[model samples]
Target: MRPLKSLVAASVLLSGCNGMPVAFTQDPVYDQAFVVHSGGPLPYMLMGTAVQWNEEYAVTVKHIPYVPGSVYQGQGDIQFFRHKANGVPLWRGYTPGEAVTAVGYNSLYMSVKGSGHALPAMVRLDAKEGNVLYGTHDGPVAKGMSGGPVFAADGKVVGITVAFLSSSELAALKRPDLASQSRVSIFLPYAEINREWGRYLAQAQPVTAAPTHLASR
Candidate 1:
């Protein structure tokens, strides 16, 4: 079994005055994800990534840090207006060994020249539990990637990244063989996200096109 303290939740937050300007992707499928931030002084700093679940609702990992009494107070509150999301994607379950892309707003990556806020991470699904999905990717899991969406092969969002087990954590857990390997990202399955935010999610109705107006012919 893994050590209880193995998981590290991404908590690096950046505000506009202290970090890069907010960025976004042109692809609508990946654009559904957005950065979270505080409203005051550092209004543009990225707090974390969140996926648009509907016209009025978005889903993010529960571990993201938030300022007290603000719109992003914490898990207790369901309102998030610090930053805006571009679009919404469909959801589905994941299968082992399935190829997926995790889209997140990495703090360090965004600050670098030309890097967009929404990063697409290619990872292979490894396991699933009651509340989380486990996956392995080639590179390091950077801070601020938390709350990003894990998209399945069909472009559907399957999970929301929450944490990752670092190589050191593997050593602590007595898995020396895997200690030298890359980090294992942890995500909250889409189903669980729905359950966690059911009250608010249920309130957002699917958007419908406005009726076309035609002059009487």
Candidate 2:
């Protein structure tokens, strides 16, 4: 996600003064979800742009007295949890160890076939306990599978199924050492999207109107 420099600057200006809570007289807006998908069975990660900022707040009173905006690009994986609806999330952590492929519109694809180099597999996890969910045997990813939704048992769209890993990468799996450590494909976390929801909304929101007194002065 891209960061908001304007908001960061505004926060800095507001920080200089302290007293009442400042209201963002304007409404908040956000952008559409952006994602990247992997080609095969490995997990996919989510990425987006955002604005980072520093704020000053009173220790006694839980309030933000100042805010600054600096724009930056942020990325993370889509994690799955049970308590929610669709597996899609607004924010989450980054999982670098997981191999990911780039798909259009911030979505990722992974595989599950054990024999194939990088096979795509759905990430089945216990929502309540956060345990790995698995099936009886490895499954093959079909052509039409790409872009299809990967859901938890609760029917949450945790990720989109992409492609498989290349033959060379698959070949590496033949080694007992590699097979133990690596999987054919990866699953993208849904939580990654939830984390940037605020900034995305802010970017889309209409800029607030300057106060009448300030405008006249």
TM-scores of all models? 0.57, 0.28
Residue-wise lDDT of candidate 2 within 36-153, one digit each (tens)?
Answer: 2221233332222111111211000001111112122223222221121232222223233332221212112222211112222333322332343221112233322322233332
RMSD of candidates 1 onward, in order: 11.1, 21.1
RMSD of 2: 21.1
Our tally of clashes for model 2 stands at 76
lDDT of each: 0.50, 0.27
Give the residue spans of candidate 1 off by over 4 A.
Answer: 1-7, 10-25, 39-46, 67-87, 108-140, 171-181, 199-217
Per-residue CA lDDT of model 1 for 145-184, tens digit only, reads 6667777768898776665554555455565444555545
Q: Which candidate's TM-score is highest?
A: 1
True lDDT of residue 88, candidate 2: 26
Error of 1 at 10 (Å): 6.6
TM-score of 2: 0.28
Candidate 2, position 92, lDDT: 27
